[model samples]
Target: MTADTNTDLDTAQLPPPAEKSARALARARKRRSVARFWREYRTHRSGLWGLAGLILIALIAICAPLLVGADSQSVTDAPGGALEAPSGEFPLGTDQFGRSVLALLVWGARVSLTVGLLAAFLCVAIGTVVGIVAGHFRGWYSTVLMRVTDWFLVMPTLVLAIALATVMSRSIWTVILAIGVTTWPTTARLVRAQTLAVESRPYIERARALGGGHRHIMLRHVLPNVMPLVLAQTTLVISGAILTEATLAFLGLGDPTITSWGGMLQDAREAGAVSAGDWWYLAPPGLAIALVALAFTLCGRAIEAVLNPKLGVAR
Candidate 1:
């Protein structure tokens, strides 16, 4: 090849080297971001452990039924199966009807997780809309919306939930709906505050001056800024909803057909498992609920620290 051609080839090869360097730098930055998140996460040791415990419980819940090869509610009328202690045959023992407590705990995890996640999503959707409208549009609109929020805020959630569950029918979906509806008020209040703050920012004014539509500014600008708060609140709300569902189920407001942790607890209580000294019957479900709630609470706190660096405990 000619010297000129060789020189051009060399230049082309140099650009590839530069491109590789840029790519490497980008990857390094991504790694740093991940490391920073974990570092922040580790700052809150309790929260991290909580998240780990929750994840463990969820995994167990998801895998339990598959491992056991028995339906959560299956009744085995084997002699001496009822209220058996933890043994090789039955890890967490058997219920009054000879159902494996371990199996029920696992299946119940699925139900509780599903309810928590679904209810949290519902709350975020309804709350975001209400918050955006109330915060973005002041005067009569804001006043009316705020008043409605107040009405919900004043109602006792558990009491209202019982009434709703009684009226609507004792099902998982009903529990989800009741918990979701009642839970949105707190998120709405939080989102509204964030929306107001975002609306007052200089960029929002710039967007307005640039002839951006209200919808565009709100969705692109305000919503993005407030998303962190929404996410944190979502985690907290999910934990609360899960607990509430369990409480309702414990009170016999849950679907009889479902094998939920709460329902299991209710059954145990009704059968006098505690009084009869059947620790296996009550322990698994109760521990599952507590561990799941603890996990959510920790995750929420971790996310809060990540979103707000000032509050982050230093590693």
Candidate 2:
């Protein structure tokens, strides 16, 4: 009996299975989720294509400096003159300033992508906070918050963005801020709806019963469950943000220092590239914008279908 008790005590003293830290466990789960998502995404042809296109765009953006050469910034205009035709020397032709269309297109990718990603991140962060708080706390506060969200939702997004941009300086960051601030309502609404469903689940009730605080339960329990939806929405938001930035830039609201696809289009329009049938100047930037939007849309749809199985139909 003495030996058995000592053995039992030793067993009890042994550290409990060297269990992983919560952070480590969370990381492992995230890795597993990513793997699962990739496996599922593989079957989606459009999604695969979209992913490939985005990769290609990113690669182009990264390689712009190398491809554009050392004099890219200074050599905005070609010696060949404006509205030049496509040839080996001036592939994609030249703009009104005789700027290499290919160079402008590559540099434009950097601006559009940076704006889209940063603005989407800002909007998603704001929306997630508003959504989680409103959804978790039901009552007068929730009603008020939802009402505020509704007010924003009912407003014309582009109009509000344009107003904001007009009020602020004409810069890339200003445009990003305008779009981010104006676009959060839709994301907030989506997150709130998902949060409500998550809050009503049995596990959430148990977490509450176990003396979990509001912050603890909401962050530790609720947020993870709603993240897939948030991620899917984020992709959609990026596409919208890109389009919004383009619209703003096209309307002469863009930073004069930067050259974006929309700015290219605006310049082309002003130069009568369309009327003159300068397809090279007009098509490359337009195609870049469309391709980016289409890629994000495809990815968002695929993620939505996979995460929200109810929406997964034969497509």
Candidate 3:
């Protein structure tokens, strides 16, 4: 029994296996990285505020199912009179259809947030790929790609998006596609500049000398270095995408079946709320849109500051 106890103690005291030790070290490094990120992020007051606002908005969007019911959106089953003023029963007042405006606003957040995130992601994905390829491969091929990007860049993004939206069937996906394709040139330009800077470093030459193929060099070396810039750009793109969605929806190009901020504005216009002086009907959605855009912009600036220390010092 003594020998068994000694053996067990010895086993317990032995160092961990190579794989387990490696995993533990990796986890420790990750924790340190996350801690360092938060510490740096805290120094940016604007970023903190923006993060708070975004969290609040995201939480509200997530909790829509719990906060309100489907009945609030039903025109036929509306509990309030048409264009009623704000009250305890109808907080933000009723719309033209007698549906609760507050409910519509909350529900609208879902669409705006969804479209903004998805469209921005698509835009960044395309831009990152294009930028990496363009930066890594120079010569006539890169020149042609850059010329195509410049063509898209010089054209007014809104006009191009509107043209695309007009051609496609009206739906959130169409809105996303239009915004994604139109807005990517800016990101591509930014990322391409960064990629060029990264690739110019001596490490890239060493990587090439070590038999690293194009795929290996890009994915392993170039991509990770440019990720911070990509992350910062994504926030700005989200704000633009949201605004574009609002524009498209307000112009009656949105899916007629859904409740969105721009759709609410369109409905208000059709209902003559502006002329009727029903400010409650018009204000909520407009304010919400502005706040969301501002929040994202603030967050983007803060992220840029955090990622690039020079910006942080300037602030």
Candidate 4:
């Protein structure tokens, strides 16, 4: 190549001297942190297994329409007799309404998982906001917020949820709302502790000296630091939320029009499945609930271990 052509190529390859913006640096750091977290999380075998199970269950719920037709819920057009035991025609048998037990299980997963995830996220969102505000702001505001959280903390969560569900409409949304409101106290407390610790750091004073407002301080500094604790708490909250949904459904508080794990148990009880020794009708839903709860619990524990290696050592 000519000297002029080689000089032009070298000049074109030169990088600009300008540094990355503060926002860009923050985003890069966040991406790196998330990548590190995932790498650490994969080291936990139990966490990987639990994550796989959750993905499988979620996929099944999302693909329910393709796997089983919507007609599976039709009582009049049921493919088998009412309360039929497992046979060549019906693998999991039939419920009291003559619907295929296998179809009911699949459909129930959608509702149960929906309620669990929505309720858990709603609770965590509220909890994170409350905890951050309470921790960052002192005096009466913090006192009032903490007092409210404490009241919810001291009271029976299930009782509050039951009362809310009973007074409100009987629907999936209502169930989600009830569980979310009642189960947020623990999360709030945990996040508040983390927030307090973060606020005590030296950089917090530096941010304030540079004229950071409350919004800027909390969003830029406090929230990111406390997010790990919040994330860990969410998976644990999901398990409790699922259990609460099941309890509410079992108590006949869930919308009767839909099929859910707890609703199936309630139906089997009402239909004398237990009286007639129909194990197929009762066992599947019960086992499904137990398995889902266990999966979430394992995931939460694994996440905790990833965040705090000391906990893993303690275990």
Candidate closest to the true structure, highest TM-score: 3
**Candidate 3, run of 10 with poorest lDDT:** 306-315
Ranking by lDDT: 4, 3, 2, 1
- How many clashing residue pairs are found in candidate 3? 0
- Which lDDT value does model 4 have at 78? 88
Predicted candidate 4 versus true structure: per-residue lDDT over 98-181, tens digit per residue? 889999999999999999999999999999999999999999999999999999999999999999999999999999999999
For all predicted structures, in order, the TM-scores are 0.85, 0.91, 0.92, 0.91
As a whole number from 0 to 100, the lDDT of residue 88 in candidate 3 is 97
Ranking by TM-score: 3, 4, 2, 1
Q: Write the per-residue lDDT of candidate 2 for residues 92-160, one digit (tens) a residue.
A: 888877778888899999999999999999999999999999999989989999999999899999999
Candidate 1 vs candidate 3: the lDDT winner is 3
Cα lDDT tens digits, model 1, 148-264, are 998988999888888889999777899999888887888899999999998988989999999999899888998978988998888888889899999999999989988888999
Q: Model 3 RMSD to the real structure?
A: 3.8
Best by lDDT: 4
List ranges where model 4 is wrong by over 4 Å: 1-28, 313-315
Off by over 4 Å in 2: 1-17, 21-28, 75-77, 313-315
Angstrom error at residue 267, model 1: 0.2
In candidate 2, which residue pairs clash?
Answer: none
Better candidate by TM-score, 1 or 3:
3
lDDT of each: 0.85, 0.89, 0.91, 0.92
